[model samples]
Target: MEVLEAIWGLLAVALLAFGLYCCYVKYVHLKYDYIPGAPRASFFFGHLPYFWRKLKNKEVAHDLFIQWAEEHGPILRINYLHKISVVILSPEGVKEYLMLPQYPKDPDIYSMFFNIFGVRFFGNGLISDPNHERWRKQRRIMDPAFSRTYLSGLMGIFNEKAEELMKVLEEKADGETEVDVMSLLRRVTLDIIAKVAFGLELNTLHDYQTPFPRAVDLIAEGMTKIRIPFFQYIPWNRKKVKEIQDSLRLLRRTGEECFERRRKAMLNDEETPLDILTQILKSEAQEGGCDYDSMLDNFVTFFFAGHETTANLLSFTIMELGRQPEIVAKLQAEVDEFVGVRRDINYEDLGSLQYLSQVLKESLRLYPPAPGTVRWTGTENVIEGVKIPANTALNFNTYVMGRMERFFKDPLIFNPDRFGKDQPKPYYCYFPFALGPRSCIGQIFAQMEAKVIMAKLLQRFEFQLVPPQRFKVLESGTLRPFDPVVCRLNLRNPLGF
Candidate 1:
């Protein structure tokens, strides 16, 4: 009887505290009432339900943001519970915020990313770290890995993996069979990152039974659940939660084994292959070393970050090229002229494919793999004459800003010509790899890898988009083609080889 009474008393106190916190949240949120935004459907849930509904229906969240941008002007405030996040969809705002390091990534948003299903995902990794100084330290240590000399050495591996993919497609390029280009691209990119970054032979391209690829896919798919409040407690999500946890365990386990092997090699004074993992280990040793878990954090980071964005870009570019044959012909001509019948693509050949470069830039303008980045405003700020509250979530997206009519003429049209040599460069408006000090360290590396794979594909094949397939975007870790970029391929000018 006494224990029961005590439990009841504690429950009463907890309920009362929760009620007060809710009241405080509501009061604080009202402070941003002046910011222009869509009418709230409910004070408690805000737009989260709407966002979730869109995701549930296999739709992109950025489309809704674009709609609100059109309706409520470029700057809008969206609320979830008591939190108010500001969305900036203008070039001026993007320049003011993204072009400077004054803004750091939103801790609240990044905190959500630090764990998936209670397992640490990108904990303190370069992408999920909110601390500016710490992130800078990591970035400085990892810079040498992405240098031109290091990446140039990776050309052989890039060509080898791409050739494996081409051979796979060659088997299916009989024109009667439909191939899911995006899946094959994902496998090839996954294979490249594994081999180049960690010196692991993932063999995802050739091996259909790899558990790592399926685990990664599950992890990406399961990441969306992070947005739901107290998702783990929900009965329906128990199976999903367990699956995500299992996937995370597999990745972390593999990461630990890889780290141990590298450490053992260094300890034995063995010949360590110069790769990203070696660079990280060298940095760790020189810097008096970080914990093993810290190394694991980066190992997982490099695997996901180094692979998905490049694959998405390549796949999206392929889909667009299929839709526009004339543009494809132009790209093919550039590749043919520069690359000729060479099966081996060198770093020098990457620069001369100017038309292909424009096509890539144009594709990124439309479908930025990561969509956008969010910044946490710790103090009140002003942008474009509008007052912004402190402690607000600020979202700036290339996808939104790149599509605005004010920034790009005929924004809806996919025109690679807009990126012609004579055309003015998009300074602030175009940030596919983001901008400022927090910009992606692997930008050059990703683009170079993309160019190699794309050059080879264009040189070898003529692909037609399979009809009845929706070319929409999937909001996974990166935005991928919703229908997997299904295509029917035929060898183009077989004698050219």
Candidate 2:
């Protein structure tokens, strides 16, 4: 009789706790009732069920956000439980939030990236570092590596790596063999970044079995998987979680080895190239402390930031060119005129390819690899005449804005003429690299490398997309083609260059 009484008493306490938690959730929901958002699917989950359903349908997540913006108007709110995100789709909102003030990145989102599955990932790296003063200090120290003079000196390295890709393409340009151009582009960009930034020879293009590239793909997959709440806790996710952890370990181990070699070189008074690695070492020396973990954070950061987005950019450009022969013809004409019979494309040549620039800009508008940036606001503000409460996450996406009818005419159409010489540039509506104080430092570097690879491809090959292809976008941490973008390549008739 006594044991039964005790069991009943414990059950009563559990029920009371559950009741209080539900009441708290209800209270929070009522607090944000003024913000326009979809009705909560459940008293506890708060829109997660609807989001999960969309994910199950294989729709890109951001596309759903765009749909919501169109339906609910520009300044709409989305909630994942207590976390409320105010997605700003209007140019005015974007200018006010992202450009005018230097709002700190949302800690809820960025802090999650500091570690993945209990392993340190991007802790204090330039990309994930939330502290403004430290980031500014690091940025100032690292700026010289991306200066115009330094980049001009990198043209030879860019040309050398691009030429290596052309040789690889030449072997496969039989016009009958189907080539996964996206994969090849990823490899080339990987090689370029490794060689140029770290002074390492990661010839991934020649060797498909390299562990480094696989590790990168796994880390990217991990980044995407980590976003799903409690993903690592599920029983079925054990193997996937283990794979992600292993990849993180491998990448960090490689970074450590590279850093050690450079450190020893510096200690021994050996000659070192003024590459990004050297700059990082110099920064550490000036600080008078050796934070190897922080150094490795940047090493991992650049390995991803320096290469993945650019590779995706080139892949999307090629995919569009394959579908539209007119665009390809124009690109070929521009390349032929500027780079006629020239094997080496110099820095001066990149500026003259105006039409090519427009094509790339159009591609970015349609498919920016890193589509959005998030900022957190600590004070209440009004945007688009809507009252946004304090402590809200302000979300800005170029992808949704680039496609919105309010921002661009015929937004769904892929037309480079929107960026033609006589056209008026979109005002605050197009920022693929973001804007204001914290815009991408490597913007010019990325575009320069892209122009070199693309100009060469236009000079040498005519590519056709494989039939029945699905031109869908995938958001795996960054945006990329859902398909591998397979194509058939043939050498240009008469070999114009």
Candidate 3:
């Protein structure tokens, strides 16, 4: 009885200590109350309760950010558990935070990106690495792979993969069959990236049951699901977590196999395709070399980032064109003018489709993949009279800025003419690919691929948006269609001119 009493006393003391720690964390979070934000749903939980409720309803974090931006103005603060998250909605604030090298990516947030469910997803890769110098070194070494010359040489592969998609869509273009174009486009993009980046023939466009594509889908789903607190402990979530883990293992294994194959090919002095994998391997060979894990990190990063963003971009653009018929007619005319009867799209054809560029730009404005990024403020600073505390996590989101009426007139409308060659570009506000030194390195590569696929689609089909489909955007790691872009497509004019 005496021993039991002693044990109870110790347990009570431990609980008290934990409770006090929670109180202290709340105190620090509440100190930023003067920075203007929504009423806290709970003193202990801060905004997490509210955030959880929204998340449960499939609403993304950005929806609340926009609401707070409206209520509290451009630069506002909110308590996210023990952390003070300051959202920058103004163009100036975004420019200040993103353009400068002094502000590094927030370790707390980006560290989450380095792993998914304890598996190294993008571990220490260029996308997830917060170290300035190391990232710079990696970026510099990988730059040549995405150079205009190298990308220009890959036009044949892009055309081949995109045409594969066209053939699939053609079979479904019966004017009555509703097809999920987003899924089809995703498969094609996956094939393109696999071929171009790793010299692998995924053939996902023709075959969807492939393990690699399935693994990729699960990993993407897991990245979002893992963000939920106590997800692993929940009964329903355990299965999902396990699937994600299995998928990660599969991805790592495949990457290792590919790496070994490429390495041996090099060792044997056999000819190898000058692809992104070759460049990454060459980078490893030079400058003291990179480890297998880091190389795998790059493999996953390049594979996903290479394909996913551009696929969504094209998906959203196609959806927008279906909604706006006049724009479709106009874009189709341009495609017919520049790329008439041409089965293969050349690099010059990509540039000549100028209006298509504007359409793509506008689509990205509405639906930017990887919409926002967070930075850890190294020093205390004032932005437009508000005092920003040091060590705060600052968020810059194009999704919020793109919808701001101040940035673009009629911000809600999908108007391609806003990016007309004669029109003056919006300053610092429209960063679908982000801005500054940390901007997406694959911007040119992605756009080139998008132009080729889009030009072919325009020349071939007239897409009609199917009813009962919500065109809403779902904020995954990237902004994707809540419902995949479902459409009934018909061969344009039916008669070759």
Candidate 4:
């Protein structure tokens, strides 16, 4: 113990000396790109404490980013977790930086996830693979599956899952029952992703001992395990890596069945398309669409980015509804009024839920599924009059952007009215969907799914937050509700909506 303490003491001294040297170099020799308000150097510890404190409370990170922005102006440099990560605050800067191909997805983001998943990208869709050309090609084919018209067809899948969710709630809500709404959302989402994306009927909502459903959870949890610096580098992380791979291998086995099932269905030229698997199979049927190996990668990406993100958003939105009764009532009214006219909402109906859409917009503003988008500059560039040195990492945190006072008056308030026709936030100020060349291709698909799921939920039961239950958001790969958003689902008098 004495020797260990001695080592730690020595390490601390080394860190302190290194920090001081960086300050001296920046202050005396190098005129650092000074953003006015960034944390000035401390001899013992640079910007480390502030970064650590900010990340401890996930909600605070964006606010700190805003604070740094306010102090240093727009483009500012701050060292975080021993790395010099720059926070670019302005929308113009985001556009400029994200537009340039010189900035690519950081190796760390993929590496951490790859370590967790126990697999490498075999040329996937837009998200996982490094090859831009292959990604672009696959994106074009996969794009149609998430198009406006395509989402309309998929509404039934969401509605079905929502209905299944309600059934689970009803089954469990007998007496003083506390429901893990987030868990159910995960199940429904898993089922929906399986049915829609893989053409497999997981029915995780119904089944407990399913390989695919368990695999999904393992992947999510395993992915989180890899985020730690210890897991990223240490020898013990190898065991964790194997567990993650086992989870992914199970998923891949499921995906293989999906691949073969869809191919057979396609060969028969059946009149009915199964789901996203059908779309992928159809795309692959054409020459130069997606090769077999790449299709598997897309299957994985679709499961994670499409199913997982939407599920987390649904969970977050539901929790928000439980907390904010007023928003829930207003959204429920819109659902009732819309259903009164349309009977069953069609594609046009999905487009017309303006208030419901706005409410979701507000929810996402607070709890973005993907909190911070990061890019590493492959070349030197300037953002908001500040020159970013090549090889410097750029982090544009959506969680932070949504909270800046300059972006929205009373930034923390939950007000959907901000997005109303009378008051549209400037494009840069609001990019929950992101912007530029590599913007989310599935934005429309996500929005449509959110509106349908939330609208459906609000229609039947009034979801109330269980007293003081609240989530401290965590930006683990994607933004996630910490765990256990307990809620009370009380069924109201039968109302047609």
Ranking by lDDT: 2, 1, 3, 4
Q: Output the worst ten-in-a-row residue range by lDDT, candidate 2.
A: 283-292
Q: lDDT tens string, model 3, 49-107?
A: 77788767877768787788778888877776567788888777777888998888888
Candidate 1 residue lDDT tens string, 1-497: 99999999999999999999889778966788788888877777787777778888988878887788778888898888777888988777787777777789989888876878889888888888888888777777787887888888878888888899989998998898999998888889999999888889999988857789888877887776776679889999899889888988888899999888988999999998777888878877776667566567777777877888998999899887878989998989999899988999988999899998999999999988978899877777787678988777899888888888878999878999889999998878888998888888788889988999999998999899998767688886578888778899899977766
Question: What's the residue-level lDDT of 213 in candidate 2?
Answer: 85
For model 4, give the 10-residue run with minimal summed lDDT: 28-37
lDDT of 2 by residue, 222-272 (tens): 998987879999999999999889988888898999988998999999998
Where does candidate 2 clash, by residue pair? Answer: none
- Candidate 4 clashing pairs? 36-72, 37-71, 37-72, 62-400
What are the lDDT scores of the predictions, listed in order? 0.85, 0.85, 0.84, 0.69
Cα lDDT for residue 100, model 2? 52
Q: Model 3, which residues run further than 4 Å from truth?
A: 235-237, 493-497
**Cα deviation in Å at residue 275, candidate 4?**
1.7
Residue lDDT tens for model 4, 426-465: 6675667666656787788777666766766676666666
What's the ranking of the predictions by TM-score, best on top? 3, 2, 1, 4
